[model samples]
Target chain A: MDLNLTILGCHSATPRANAFPTSQYLEINNRHFLIDCGEGTQRQMRKYKIGFSKINHIFISHLHGDHFFGLIGLISTFGILNREKPLHIYGPKGIKEVTILQLKLSKSWTKYDIIFHELSSKESEVIFEDEKVTVKTIPLDHRVYTNGFLFTEKPKLKKLHIEKIKQYDEIEKCDYNNLKSGKDFKLSSGEIIPNNQLTLEPDTPKSFAFCSDTSYKPDIVPIIKDVDVLYHEATFLKDREDLCEKTKHSTAEQAASIADQANAGKLIIGHYSSRYKDIAEFKKEAETVFSNVELAEAGKRYSINSYPIEILN
Target chain B: MDLNLTILGCHSATPRANAFPTSQYLEINNRHFLIDCGEGTQRQMRKYKIGFSKINHIFISHLHGDHFFGLIGLISTFGILNREKPLHIYGPKGIKEVTILQLKLSKSWTKYDIIFHELSSKESEVIFEDEKVTVKTIPLDHRVYTNGFLFTEKPKLKKLHIEKIKQYDEIEKCDYNNLKSGKDFKLSSGEIIPNNQLTLEPDTPKSFAFCSDTSYKPDIVPIIKDVDVLYHEATFLKDREDLCEKTKHSTAEQAASIADQANAGKLIIGHYSSRYKDIAEFKKEAETVFSNVELAEAGKRYSINSYPIEILN
Candidate 1:
């Protein structure tokens, strides 16, 4: 399992010279996905060396400017770059209308086709699927209609125990694929070799969940249970818990509580309000609730496949 | 006369690390105006220490994404900051529709009013005027419906010659405002002191013209003649003069030709295409025809009021 996540911008409310809004780049199973592009996301992508052509799919959490304001700009740049492939965008309803209107007014209709998938479902359902990965939506409670995305790698085919298979002469090279498919090996002597004994179990698939700008919603834990990595919004600390309810945000303690309830392997918390002077306090408070916690910083990359969660700045 | 210009972003197409798109902060006669906000204009404003509240008016040159993609983000930030004063936006006919659509979809309606002044004129016309400054649209030839802007400070009140007034005690302090209005003072003896003799002529009013994303339209020389400063888009050098016609852009030599014909005090050329390796070439080529030329660089401030044109990094 190989998965890498880059935090582009994580600050909340407004963008400052030092503080950017929420945007991230995720790479899993050699597939690239951009989540929640804020105002400076493209610059951040350039800073982080994320190629523009690598991304064919973009997932927007909601219609908030902090989450998706850079979509139109990025799309226009693709036109300037002469991208020929069609781009797919998934977001809340009305996304296509707003995007198309800007394009029409600018008279910058891209030669490349734009495929929009507007999601209005309230229930958690799979929205994207391929041979390698599947993406599901985790409906969240927020001021606006929003959804968190869960990305999971599909299960791998069974691996054959080459040394054990060599012991049986009946197991020819032509039957290797069938044996790898977890079928029992039948011999001409009317004897049967169990599939489990002939093949060892493959490595477990990895999963990542991204949730942001939502209040304390316990129901999401069930949808993202046992996720290898969970990135949640922690806009404030426990001291400002009272503001969380009104703002429809979550505190660091609340984010960690959700991570603990879901038994996530690791938790990354971000979307800090600009009012906070220190982000270390978020980590200190979240650690008390969940043992494994990491603070999301701009330009930081987290690799959960490595033991102890390898982080690169 | 005090006029300061800050180059926020002056690149032609997409924004790069060091090259911004097209955005400038102009301070003329104590009025702040933002011109052509590209994708990262707000961040550049923060870098240049331009206060968000200081800007009351924003002017867009055209509907190109690089020219005005940052408008929605800046407007949304104003909402998050709880700005109470109404924001005035001046641009093309579709500016209001595109901006309002984004705000509406975000559900982040601002408490402050957004006064949009949409322009659809093909001739030079005054769009905004107050006591100190006047802004007029300079129609340009572009691929789309585009317009340049000319900002000029109104002629100031005449200065009161204290020494000359002391020579004639009949010129009472109460009559000072009347004299400042360029009115001749009438003595009780029926002898009139000529207005020019009573007050020295005030410093010549300063003017700045912003022309971008346009081809060589020499017809505008009469409209902006004797302008103190001219900021023109030189997207290509003389070597790529062929592209200017097809792309509806101007070369360095063409920009210099316009400045020379208009008799501008200073010529600032920007909006350089990314293909050029060095921006110094723009200044070199422009200076061949125009004596005083400056290359636009991000974070540089040019003050034309001072001798030799004060440039601060």
Candidate 2:
């Protein structure tokens, strides 16, 4: 199983010729999810060769246009493509009304089921859980009601040591399932084999945190602490710290501070403001506070397991 | 006073990597207006070098997501840019509710005034009028409540014959204004010069009819009859005629039929279906019915006054 994050867009406020607003595609435990679909997200997905049918879940952080304007277009496109699979969407409360109104006015009732999980809770809560992954919401402080999502892979079953298991002929294939579940193996000859001796624990579960468009509040550090990968928004530089405070956005320094406090394995900073002509300054600013900082570029993919080892900038 | 049309996007249904949905910018008599702002329209405008401040009026054809999805993003961008001028949006009745709800949820009240003129009348009515242009709505036949806009440049002032006016020394610069307004010049010697002899008629007031996402209805022919330029939606080819009828969309041949019946000066067909890999087929199909036909391409500009002479393929 692979845990990967693909940056569809990373600019802030408005979309430009080369830079787009916030949108990302996350692939975890063989499940695909779209996060914060900004305007022109579908085009970005096409440009990155991400198939539309693979995305069954979409998570929106807030009601800002840049964060969710592309949602209606994507839903309409899904309808055009005649998608039959039910699509799940998790977001703040007003999303259902906005999507329904647009669909009603256009008379484009989709053929697929659109299950909306509207959230207004201020506390961290699990929003989705399946066999492979569990998704939770991290309450964020912003001008409007917003929440960041935390995706964590469920703990894997212990892998069976083939050589050790084969030595016990009494342990059949049926009994091996029990050993893989972290149970001791009992022999007919009254010999007990320890669970650790029979099997080795699987790799630790991977976790990813996506926090964007929020102020530099340390309250979320506890919720996103120890995540394998953390993507925090760096909308402004230190020079524009005044604007960042006024707009409730974070600077590169603030993002790095959050990552450092959370002890994240890797830190990726994006959501760059169009005012800054050079992006190198952002990297320099964040590197001063955090050593393992990566710049989020569009169409670039980052693996959570490849921590400390940079993928692409 | 130039009447020009810039194709911001022309594809139908979904936006692709290279093809965009329906969006167009019309410059008529020094006034700029946006027609059917689909997704990625602002980026398209930037790509074509159309300034955001230049557009004060936006006319939406219907409530379809592709037609109006970009409107909210553009409004948000204007707010981000600190636009002070009031922006006017004219669309179907439900547009106001949809736009207002999104803004309220985001708490992004724009600094500029957004005045929405919602139209519901089935009869053709003047929805917008200024000193230079008058926009009328042509009720269209579609699955939902839809209307196409007819942008007509107000009758221009007669051009002054500089050589003829110079010969009369008694004609002052201030008096030339009266002659341009179609008033006969009265000399101090009591000699009256006829308006036609002193000035030439301004280039016949140019008109452009944009009929999109509508079925093949001949009734609109009278409303858009003999227009300088007609852009009709041809969402399908002859092979998909049945699908067109079922979806209330038009084929290339049907679009050309409407142009021929209206005796349009020139015809441009767009809103291409994503299913068609080759666009030349649409041109070949429409040319069989109307000789002066062109395919609408993204970023292409069409001059209404330059009929019969193709600007770009």
Candidate 3:
């Protein structure tokens, strides 16, 4: 399974020249999941060559315009292009009303089915699960009802047993399928064959966590602990600590501090202020606390394998 | 007065790699006015080096996502930048609701005052005006309640009478300013200098009309008649006439026919379909009917002066 995450947008409430708002595309087990579609996100996705047809599920962290403004456009484009596949969207309660109102006003109703999962309260709820992965929610502290998402790969199956299977002529033929199915079987040689003898250990399950537009809170630590990749909002620098406090946002140092406390394998910071001409200051500030700090630039990709996260800068 | 029009986005509903959606920057008399802010419009404005601070008024044709998706992000950016100037927006009735709902959900209120003039009917009405130009709506046939805008320049002041101002002490001392201001004076010879003697005729006012997302309709001719430049949507080629009719859009030949009927001096076609690989087909199709046909490409500029419209291809 190739687990890759592409950063479509990395800015905060404000959009800058070269940077986009908050949006990301996660690919795992040949399935595409979109997280936080901000304004101009579809164009960014088009620029990055992400196929629109591949995106079936969308998870929105909150109702901030930077997180979901592009949803309407992407939805409308899907309608214009006459898509027939259903699109599943999970977000806060107000998202349905906003999306519905736009469609009603424009009289541009979609042809495909759109299933909306409106989340209202804070809970560690299991939202989605497939054969390869399971997703949950991590509560976040923000001015609004914000939450983060935790995607954890499911554990691999146990290996099969191979020894002592050739001794039986009648029983071995009958129970050979059971041995290959990772079951301990009684052979004709009067020996018990363990299920772990045939195959090696399965690969480790990789995980990714997305935390958006929130203040520094330690509550999410347990839910996102030791994740392979963690994307946290770093809206301001250390110098603008007062502004960060005033706006209920986190500075780069604070985001890095949370990543350190959560014991995250890699820390990816985004949602920068437009005032900063160069973002080197943010990486420098975060690297003081976290060793593996990657600035989440728009259009950049970060890969999370079983080994370690590598950034395509 | 400096009158320059920059095509920020030129493609129609279907998006392409290089061409953008429908958006244009109209610069006249040192003021910038944006027409139809499509998706990725802010980035397009930046690419053309149009100062965002100079834009004061925004006119939206309809509630289509491609026409106004970038508006919320642009407004949010203005708030983040702490802009003090007010932004005036003119659109259909639903626009205000959409904008206000997004702001409420994000919990991010704008710092500057925003004025919305919502249009409810298809009647032509003046939406914005300054010293040099006025913007009025020209209703058209579309799938939605869409309308086009006609930007006509106000007539220039009469030229100064420089010849008869040789002896008047108070008026002649001020040079050409006195004559252009239409100030009259009595000469030392006991004869009044008439205003008509030393002045030639003032030049004609230059105008530009923008018609977006409209089908073939001859009724729009009177509203945009005799304009210096006309930008009409040519969403399809001549071969796809039935598709244009079914989709409620216009083909290149239909757009050229409208320009011919309106007697516009220059015809600039845009809002192209993404299906066409080469845009030369559009120009060729339109030029067969209208001689002065030009294709509107992104980053292209059309300068409007007393002379003919000059396109910087």
Candidate 4:
């Protein structure tokens, strides 16, 4: 299975005319998720032609204004659109209080239920799970209580080998599920037919990790190891590495190092400080540590197998 | 002597890629004030090159999401920019609670002081006053406790009649103040020179009223009478006049009627619904009731004397 990650916004700090704050749209195993909705995210979503109605779940990294300032606005929009489906939001503990308070004040309460899964754990744990995907928190080191998320597609159901199954009339349609589950079928004569011959292996599940506004924490490598795509914040360059410590953010080189150490399939670095005029320099510096690195730009869609970014006009 | 009004955003309901919500940047008497900061206001400000730093005062008309969703984001950006000037915000009663709750959760406290002037009056009252201008509330008929803002420039000091002043060498710089204040100057010879002889007439003070998302309420005519410029919400066309009472929004014709009754110098109608494919139709509809009607567009500026809109490139 393939995973599609669309960058709605990737700029750091405040939102400018040209640069937007952090926000992204992700699709994995037919499930859509919104990550880190900063200010102007709704406009970006509209600009990129993202079917915002598809997103039922949102994963927020932190409570920082740049990361989640757009949450209330989006929620208010949902209310105006008369959305009836429940929206599940996962974020820091204070998210619920702040969001509810704004809705209370605006009196723009939505008919749809807003299910909040407040996060407080400092350790990695499964936060969302369904038949198609499982989402885990990647506890991050930031100024505020923050958590990155690991979205992993669940193993798909094995496909039926029609040719092999058709050869044996004894194997009824009811027995197809057992064979797909890797269970051997027993014929009427007591002879067992191996499930491998009747079923084809499904595609491998894909995983993506989103980590932004955090220090260079190498301990997260194990949890995100072998992820198909890794989105890490590279707020500064190697020349400004000292500022990273004080700001609790990572440099381009530092983000690349984490990608190299984790052995990730591909690294997507963004959340760049406005100080650097050229963002291409970030990729150049990151390449020194990790060869497979992609620069994140707003409206660019990154599909793991397709290395080139697909930009929305 | 002139009022420059820039439409930051002028669409109704939720923000879209082509349309923004209600927000405007007004410059009167050298004072910059932001009115109704809807979502993406900061981005619009940056796009229009509006000096956001000059906005020491913000006036929110209502607590609707489209009216003030961007307040927190703007506040946060000010904090990031390290603004030290005290910011003044005037809005509905619950604004202070909602804004404070968000800041508390994000911990993005500004070093500068935020003075909130919450309003709950049902009648027109002066909410803000300075030596140069005074801001008053225009009680409106909306779904919520909403109040529109009226900004009026204070009377300026009289200009000195250079030829007359030079003729009387006894009138020192000290006597100039008294003459400018419309007081007769008494010379050392015990002769009084009338103030009219020493000073010329000053330009007439201008006033602008911003009324958004209100039903056709003729009662507000007296409050905004003779204003140099008036911005009123025309969320629907005359075709949807029946919806006005229920939605508490005005049609283009209705907005024009109010402006016509108030004897306003000019009328700018906006907050158009997305249902209308062509906003030009709104202008055509409004022209039936009022002659001087300007269609509001984001980034387009209206300076009363200029008559024509100065669109930012």
Q: Each model's number of backbone clashes?
A: 0, 0, 0, 0
Candidate 2, CAPRI quality class derived from DockQ? high
Clashing pairs in 1: none
| DockQ, structure candidate 4 | 0.81
Model 2, range A64-103, lDDT digits (tens) per residue?
A: 9889999999999999988999999999999999999999
lDDT of 1 by residue, A49-95 (tens): 99999999999999999999888988998998999999999999999
Q: Runs in model 4 with CA error above 4 Å?
A: A169-175, A186-191, A305-313, B167-174, B184-193, B305-313
Two-way lDDT contest, 1 vs 2, winner: 1
Error of 1 at A164 (Å): 5.2
- Global Cα RMSD, each model: 2.0, 1.6, 2.7, 2.2
Candidate 4 local lDDT, A1-313, one digit each (tens): 2678999999999899889999999999889999999988998999999886898999999989899988888998888878889999999998998888788877778899999999999889999999999999999899989899999999877889999999899988998888888898888999888888889997778889999979999999999998888999999998998999998999999999999999998899999999999999999999999998888999898775444433333
- Candidate 1 matches the true fold with a TM-score of 0.96
lDDT of 3 by residue, B36-148 (tens): 98877887877778888888899999888778888987888788778889999999898999899888888778989899999977789988888888899989788888889
Worst lDDT window (10 residues) for model 4 chain B?
Answer: B304-313
Error of 3 at A165 (Å): 8.0
Ranking by lDDT: 1, 2, 4, 3
**Quick one: best DockQ, which candidate?**
2
Of candidate 3 chain A, the 10-residue stretch with the lowest lDDT total is A159-168
